[model samples]
Target chain A: MLTALARDLAAPLAANGSFLIKPGVGLMVWTLLVFGLTMVLLSKLAFPRISAALERRQKAIEESIDTAERTRAEAEQILAEYRQRLQEARAQADEIIQRARQTAEVQEREAKERGQEIVAEASQRAQREIEAATKRALEELRNEVADLTITATEKVTRKALDPEDQKRLVEEALREMDFSGLSSGASNN
Target chain B: MNATETGGLPPRPAPEEARIPAPHPTDDPAPKSSVKRKLLIALGVYLAGLIALIAIYGFKGHRNELFKPQNEFKLESWVDLGIFSINKAVLYLFIAAALTCVTMIYIARRMQQRPNKVQAAVEALFRLMHDNITASAMDERMAAKWFPFIGTLFLFILFSNLVGYIPLPTNTENEINVFGLQIPSFSLYAATANLSVPLVLALTVFVSYTVEGIRAKGPIGYLKGLIPGGVQGGMAVPIFFLEVLSNLMRILSLTIRLFANILAGHLIILFMAGALAVILGSAWLGWFTLPFGIILFAFEVGLVAALQAFIFATLTAIYLGGAVAKDH
Candidate 1:
């Protein structure tokens, strides 16, 4: 059978391969069948997945890069906001400190002014007291002098002196002494 | 010698044994066991596989068939072609196809978003198929659509071509007698070397692209688009027919180009080995042809394997592009 096959093959390679010039219909047909089967199988089984895998990976990479970009931008914005807030906070604290200092100075000034006024009022009251004491002393002196005078007069012409006149004279003398002018003059001095 | 009986006359089996002297022991090729002999023989066989061998008959038994002036290429048949007998080429094709299918299926199932080293390499090759062929020739949209076909075609041809280089058992006369019947065993041949394989592949391309054109432009529109845009009046009709003729010619050209290139490469490789064998007729002389044959053999086996496939795929892509062009 092998020699027979060889013998057949030898005929084609002979001087002019009558059959060889023409391509084999059987092999061509077989090739078509085989090629078609393989192509269809490959296209169905192999190619789709290969192309799909490529495209899928490409898309995934693009998406990842996009996500990274988005996150980076957000981070930058947040940083900017954080920095701005920090600056604002710093400025506000400084303002608070400044306001506190001003308030303390204003309170000190008010207390100083109030203390000076109170000292002025106390000095005036002391002067008024001194003037009142002088007046009391003068009244007592007048009473004593009047009494002495009355006693002496009584020993001489004391019976002639009126009690009402003495009282009135003393009251008149007290009324004549104007403590306002005197005290003001005393406050000035 | 029956040299007077020409090929123009219908071939008659004249016993060639009479004119051709019986080959002596020295006329036969050196043993394959020698590294030098192996390289030279491999180179010669590689060349022999290619081209339309005019008169290179195969070895006489185990003789130096190379550089024998009147020899014809040995068209060994595990089965026969002229008589429609299935050959070893068919068996090899099936084996090659099966291996390709199994490998592809395994790699494909394990395909990953984050690929392993093997997957990455496979992806690179796959992407190269698209980039080199489809994307280079057509628009992104078209490339996407056509990638499956083009990529499959390239890889299938490439695998088929590469597998052909695998050394099969030399088809020297073998005898194993079983019950008074002598059984003959022969070696396998590459499917790519067969003209029929390329023609069928070319036909596939031809049909697909034509269909694409028709699908792109409706049947009538496609016929109309064959004409040049500028031509008007009666000239357009002739020019349109001419264009159609040119388009049809692509089928033949694609088929022959692949077939011839592979055929030629094989013939040259085989011729070299054949030459070395002949040189071996003189002792120590055959060693001189060693490096040249080995280099060529290695180059074709390594380089031409991928290149021929690439050319076929790229051309197909180009044809596909032209078919679907908006202007045409």
Candidate 2:
């Protein structure tokens, strides 16, 4: 089959009025003219614009990337600063709370001390007042006891005694009587 | 040579053959069985399709109008004006050139920072030519200088090759009847497939590179630089001549590579699509060859078209770069 096909192809190739390899001057000229014009037109009109556009796009992309990188860096810096400030603020807040707590604790201790001092002073004053009152009540009781002794003597004698003798007798009676226990009781009360 | 010569004993198998093991019992059988069944079904379907085609078209295996050389590659002039005659090749060239210009200019005009799909495609093409082909082969200064020329060459050849694969109504030799009206038959032809087109383009590259070399190095220095630096004395003479020959051969190599590849692809497509069946005079044979034709067509369109253009432009850039380099 191949041999027959070759034979068929070779027959015309050999008999050729026009061969495959044969070149036409007109066609060559047209090709040159067309290609030349195409190259010139493209180089002048189309290629420069395309190249320019490509360069523009490249520049734009590079600029965009640079801008994005710069923006990212700035954002990171700002974030760092904000984080530092926040840390500082937190530290200050902690310091303020600590100082306030210390102040409250000092005030609380002073108040407690003052309350105890006031309570002690009041207790001392109350003890002094109690002593004074007890002394006054004892003096009044002694006077009443003396008056009652004189009345009992008058009723028994049925006559007035001399002042000196009465005084001496009262003195003797007060000395002989066991008034130490009565004085002790009055002091206890 | 027979077994009788071996004293009536069976011949021993070669060592490699003896080492061949039988199928292992542990191997899975389900997938293999399924694959075999699928193959059998495909074969049966292909045979049935071929029989149907034969029944419809009838086997006429004595026809002789299969391959026609003139109809395949010949250019019939539509207009004649001495050396400026317009033909099918000229029309294709004009279309390719115009398309290259319009597309580039249009895309260039509408270019945006964020490209649409079509714009992105165009930009990708531009980058491929600019970076991969041009910049990769030459320095920045040289690439800038010659980018337009090399870029145009790449785009032109690429478009020409791609446009060639499309079927158009350019086959004036054949006609089809459509509702009492006659129209030209559809055929595939690339302007780059013609010898003249690539030859002209190659000549341009050759001249441009030679000029650039001479410009960078003085004419004498350029010619002397063709020889390798290690050679001297009597050896240099032959080596210089050989180097000159090799340099001159670049033009032919560049030209023939593009032309032959495109031409051969088209010819194979033509043969496989219908010519083989037409030659065999069997209607069912066309059904058999059609799938192969489709596959080859897909390959040619998918790979060869762009690859050829890329190689051509890349070689051009390398030549230009080599011409100007201090080492050269």
Candidate 3:
């Protein structure tokens, strides 16, 4: 059955465009057209895009690396700035503290000197007052005693007051004045 | 503070403490993908071109004034070029060779800086020719030395075979004038489609191998190589003689094989295509046969072209390999 079918096909095949496959010229024409055209077309169209794409990719990669490097550098710069600012703040704070401490020390020394001067003025005033008071008291006492002494002197007239006893009373009055000056100075202090 | 600890603490703020940038990942396989994508595109374009050519032929009904069948011959005077007559065949060879050379030189020139698509494709073809044809069978270093001759041989034969199908001014079925000869100008024949072309190529290969063998091994050594070891007395001489004879036979077989393959492929395609016209008076037969004929023609032509080139290169490599073999 296959043989019969093939045989029938053969007649039609023979009648068909068989010149296209003829050995000498027909076959050669076909070969040339296929191979030559294929080569020509291949060379003309395909390779450039491939090469360009590859090169572009390589360039992009290189650029990316450069960008990363720049980023890293910027980060480092930021870190350095942070450190510098921290140091500056620390130094400023230290300076302020030192200045405050110096002011306090000077004020303390001035206050101590003012207190001593006030103490000395008070003592001098007290001493002067004490001397004045003592003089007054002695004068009053002398007046009263003088009256009594006159009466007694008249009654007891026979004997005049002795020189030794007068001398001794004058000495006692001088001692009492010194003791009063000391007590007044101590009370002012 | 401990003096050592204090020293270490100060160094903790060292200027060199900046962070190292991480290495960029180069694991992206874009290039490989791009290569594949490009190949796919090329394939698409090549197929489109084939379709375009087919459409053009189809629209025109595959008929041309020149293709109208007729045969006539007029004897023409021949110009002698010392050794051989510069006949029509020789003229065609020169023309085709000139075309191939111009194309090659143009590609090479354009490739000097960077290869554009056309140049790159051409270069890839050459690279394939070198690697698949030459280096695959022999030392790459040696292949480089012999590249010019081997590459030219493969390319010339391949193109010669391909140019056969081009319906040139000279290649009509009827009589035409070429170089002052009234002859069948366009006969749709690949040089390799003819037996003579492959025979000549084979002879060239044979001569190259023989000369190379002699050069590498010396004349005496070349002859001695034909013999196997351990042959005693008189037997050695005959064995050597037979070996030489067989080697010569190989050249003949190689030549015949290439010629037969190409010739047969062409004949089969021709016969199949011609069947329609012969059997039917109407042109419908031609159309009917065309699809199958074209399909077969494509497959056969591709096979023959590559096969011929491969066989030729393979044999040449074998010969060279033998010549340079240390054992021999």
lDDT of 3 by residue, B139-212 (tens): 87777566566666666666665665554544333567768877754444555644445555566677777787
Q: i-RMS values of the candidates, in order?
A: 3.6, 1.5, 10.7
Per-residue C-alpha lDDT of model 3 across residues A1-189, encoded as one tens digit per residue: 548735654554456534323333322333344334434433343234333444565587789899999999999999899889989988988998888889888888888888788888877777777666665665666654554554466467765556564445445544444455444554454
Q: lDDT for each of the candidates?
A: 0.71, 0.86, 0.59
Error of 2 at A54 (Å): 0.9
lDDT of 3 at B316: 75
Instruction: Return the lDDT, model 2, position B132.
Output: 89
lDDT of 1 by residue, B1-328 (tens): 2545665666566578866887896656644347687787867774554322312433322333333311222345565556455665566567667777777767887778999998898888888888978998899998988887788788778888777766565333444566996664333246777777888888889898999999999898888888867778989988988998988788788877777776656655654544434522422223334556567778877888888888889999998998888777
TM-score of chain A taken by itself, candidate 1: 0.51
Q: All candidates: CA RMSD in angstroms? A: 23.8, 16.8, 19.0
DockQ, ranked from best to worst? 2, 1, 3
Instruction: Write down the DockQ of candidate 2.
Output: 0.41
Question: What would the TM-score be for candidate 2 when compared with the true structure?
Answer: 0.81
What does the lDDT read for residue B59 in candidate 1?
A: 31
- Better-scoring candidate (DockQ), 2 or 3: 2
**Ranked by lDDT, top first:** 2, 1, 3
Error of 2 at B156 (Å): 0.4
Per-residue C-alpha lDDT of model 2 across residues B9-45, encoded as one tens digit per residue? 8876668966889778657687788889999998899
User: Of the native A-B interface contacts, what share survives in model 3?
Assistant: 0.00
